[model samples]
Target chain A: MTEPGRQGTPLIQLRGVERVYGQGDARVVALGGIDLDVWPGEFVALMGPSGSGKSTTMNILGCLDTPTRGSYRLGDLEVTELDGDGRALLRRYTLGFVFQGFHLLPRVTAQENVELPLVYQGVPTHERRLRARESLAQVGLSGREHHVPSELSGGQQQRVAIARAIVSQPKVLLADEPTGNLDSARSHEIMALLTRFNRERHLTIVMVTHEPDIAAYARRVVHFRDGHIERIEESS
Target chain B: MLGNALREAIRSLGRNALRSFLTVLGIVIGVGAVIAMVTLGRGATQAVSDQISSLGSNIVFLRPARGFGPGQSIIPFKVEDAQALAREVPGVVWSTPVSLRTLTVVAGNQSWSTTVVGAGEGYLEARRWEIVRGRGFLPSELRAGVAVCIIGQTVARELFGADDPIGQRMRVDKFSCEIIGLLDAKGQSAMGNDQDDIALIPLRTFQRRISGSTDVDSIQLSLADGVDNERVLQDIRLVLRERRHLSANMEDNFRLVDSKEIERTLTSTTRMLTTLLGAVAGISLLVGGIGIMNIMLVSVTERTREIGIRLAIGARAADVMLQFLVEAVVLSFLGGTIGIILALTFSFVAAQKLAFPFSPDYGIVVIAALFSGAIGIVFGFFPARRAARLDPIEALRHE
Candidate 1:
């Protein structure tokens, strides 16, 4: 167990983690035994083919799924064996998710989408609005708070997703294929914004992508194939 | 949480305005049917009592057990029985022995068929009948069996027309009778019969002249003031039993009908019919509740990603359940409120057309609204649970 308010410790740790779906003869392994540690203020990239188990690892790290076997610790909390509500609380206070589709509620304004986390935390309405506005401004969306997902371009919508991810100031941000749906120009723009946040705000960002240019923006890359990590590379 | 839920519900409803309206229509119709059936039932009951009271409180009807059935002799009731009851009952204010027969009445060149009733002098007091002109038949004329008659408004209009009907002669089949008196007009009965469309004559004279029998069809009885009806009825029943030589175990051969008993029967029948109508209308509410369940399930499905998003943020499963539950309840409550308003408006217009007083019980309206809300809770549970149990990843992945 890690003590609370500790500094200079890893933000996330995984030891011999394994995830299996189904049973008996029909069983499929999504993740083989693996060990990894992610320190604070680091940006890592996970690259793999389809069914290479990278997405499964991301899902587990995001608190959306539990590993069948292994010890997984998120900051000071042991999350591998957390109950439904415990996992929910871990997701609330520790993790934020960015999906490939920029899953912003279509009917709500960008500001309202960012305020959703505060709403579940029972924050006051006025304070929630202020914090959401601040997050949007921080993401370079100062004048776009009222625009819904449909009204915004692909890059703008992805920025809103990033704003939503960091609005609560979580310990880690897990983005699955963040730039997968954008054109090259929009993709580069999104990556630049992510790079700036990592350097300026010192946020720990773990992004999954197969594009070499997208991976080049990350400080470290972990390559996966056939349900196992193949190599680790330090990008220059 | 409440604000977000309310905003989301409003937005979702706004998104599919037609679907929302269609979903609520069943609830509206159900509630409207309940209000309409109950209101009209109460109004009909009130109208009946009003009409019955207008017939006066002193009148009582007596008929034989067979009740003037077809193919039965009209001489079942005896004039002697009426005389015996008049002499024996303690609260007998007055008794009118009456006999009726259908006869063709002829005057001058015109003739029409009408009912002729043979009644004693006390019949005027029993029926509250007033003489509009001329004078009543004398007691001596009744003893002498002189042929005299009192004509009603309709009979006078047919026979005398713009002229004085008193002192005129009219033919009853083969006999000539002088119209000694004219009766005031009485309004139509609730059953649409004209109360003043007949003629009255001396009981003895008619028994000898037209019926050629000494029997009376029935007798009218008027009771004294402040009389205990149950006691009087028991006393009358006892006397009639003795007069008819009825055994202790035998049922009375005559039916002594009272105004109160008739009122009770009519009110109960109206109550039963009202309940039946209300039950039929209540089925619509059940269907409406099912409609709410169906819509709520659809809503939960439509908002799957929203539920996942809220859950992913920190919302407990119970919180998600409560939001959807509240939304369903709010939808049903809105439907109930609108339905009540519409039903009241319909009842107002209907009351005017029916010529009856309009009044709705707010207690019933509130109860109905609460009942609809409960329906929402019961029906909304499954969908709310389904929403709460959604996998955040799969839900976020949903289109």
Candidate 2:
């Protein structure tokens, strides 16, 4: 479920990024002196054991959180120094996010969930409806547009979350354990969709998963241990 | 954005409708009680004013102050003193010597204990009461102490039911008196006394037949239009002083009370009660606000994951805050609206049953609604702020 589009310059850049959890005796380091770059048209998988800082690195990349110390850039924007609202606006226009839990609003219809980002953009009702319908169709959930999350199966719900993430044509897509909650069959289905989005739309993707099979779908995999990346390998 | 927020807020409430309605109940009761009490309070105040003014547009009551209160002996007034005031006092339109006694009276099949009033000529006019049927007493009938009486509507109803009492004869304590007229109904006074349960007779008839003495006490008088009640009361004081042979410097032995004074006292008393009732009801409104805050906090806690999702999807913190705040305001606003409608219906029906005045008071309705909305904002802030300030990562990870 993707579209053919152009590839541009490096979309995400991080240098010496460090994330600390607390202070003094309670202090814990999540990410330490990390340097990485994700350019347009690249599909990267992040893998790690528990508390290895892969999730923290994904959060900073997604702009859901900022590193304690880092020079972080999303395209031309200096995100590490940006305030909360600035990061929000950057996320609004430049980023799309998918969670393992498939965080489609439970009380809202699938179509409405897809229209959320545009709703924030103050899109007109007719445009929002049309675009949301198109996105739902893109995810092969056309007839299920009006169904609430609880009314759909797990795979169907994850598809709806994908529709929501990509509806706005964001510059980068961020997925944290997008297939973690699904069975093997559904997990491959979701991974195939992400791969299609990557190859066809050149949508830069940074995904975190513990599953080696899930990481295999990406062109490149970065493995982490403790608080730092152990290696970066290309699948060839 | 505002429209979206409002729609989302409404949708949020709709998701838990039973809980939302229960949450709003406190505010509804609070606002309803306040408006109802205020309307009834002012209604009672207005009713009392109307009754007092109906007594006479500009009327005063003169009575022996000595006998009316504690430790005081009876000081009687002759009918001649009423006549003297009518003839000599400035601003006096008419004066009537009044005698009131509670006694038993019987008709063919019914008997009742009621007040029998003895009043001289111009009595009804002086008291600003009306006769619905038959003629008032003639001067000759008043002077001669005829055995003729005027019945009030309640008295006639009790004695004769639907039968016209005019020209009928009823037995007084020891004698028969012919009913010459029926006074119109005056409903209940502010103090809840029935005003239509009396029978009126000539002053001389009461002094001789009922009291067995020529002694007259209370005097009721109406002043000419635009006359100062104080001036007339003072003039009557001088006339009574000279007639009773009191010394120049001594205080007159009579009491002078005006209808306006009664109205002022009634209204002031009612105003105080209205404030107190509103304050008491207002406190419950505060409780209602607290209820909103409690539910809002619960909602924020419950929807932590939703908030995180929204924030991660690029919803501003202010957007999250506004969403919660809008929900609270909508809750209280709905409660306030229901309360206003309830107050209107209740007060209208109650005023009719209680025979009190009714004013819808649109201004107060609006003010009360706004206050309820304000309460929502004030109480909802804490919970909304907590929701907005939540760390997105922690919230998304919350189980």
Q: Please give the DockQ score of every candidate, comma-separated.
A: 0.50, 0.76
- Estimate how well candidate 2 is docked, as a DockQ score: 0.76
- Fraction of true contacts retained by every candidate, in order, equals 0.57, 0.71
| Chain B TM-score (each prediction, in order) | 0.80, 0.93
**lDDT per residue as tens, model 2, B97-162:** 999998888999799989999988898988778888997898899989999999889899999999
Q: Per-residue lDDT of A106-162 in model 1, one digit per residue for the tens?
A: 888999999988887778999999999999998899999999999999899999989
Assess candidate 1 and give its TM-score to the true structure.
0.83
Per-model TM-score on C-alpha atoms: 0.83, 0.94
Q: Which ten residues in a row have the lowest lDDT in candidate 1 chain B?
A: B66-75
Q: Which CAPRI quality tier does the interface of model 2 achieve? A: medium
lDDT per residue (tens digit) for residues B1-399 in model 1: 777777766676778788877887877888887887777777777776766655556456777674233553323567777777788888878777888888999999978778899987588877667889988878888667788999889999988788998888999878999999998887665455777788888888898988898877888887776788888888878887787666787666677887767777887998899798788878888898889889889888888887777776667788888888887777777778788888889988898898666867678888888977887788788888889899888887776
DockQ of candidate 1 relative to the true structure: 0.50
Tell me, by lDDT, which candidate is best: 2
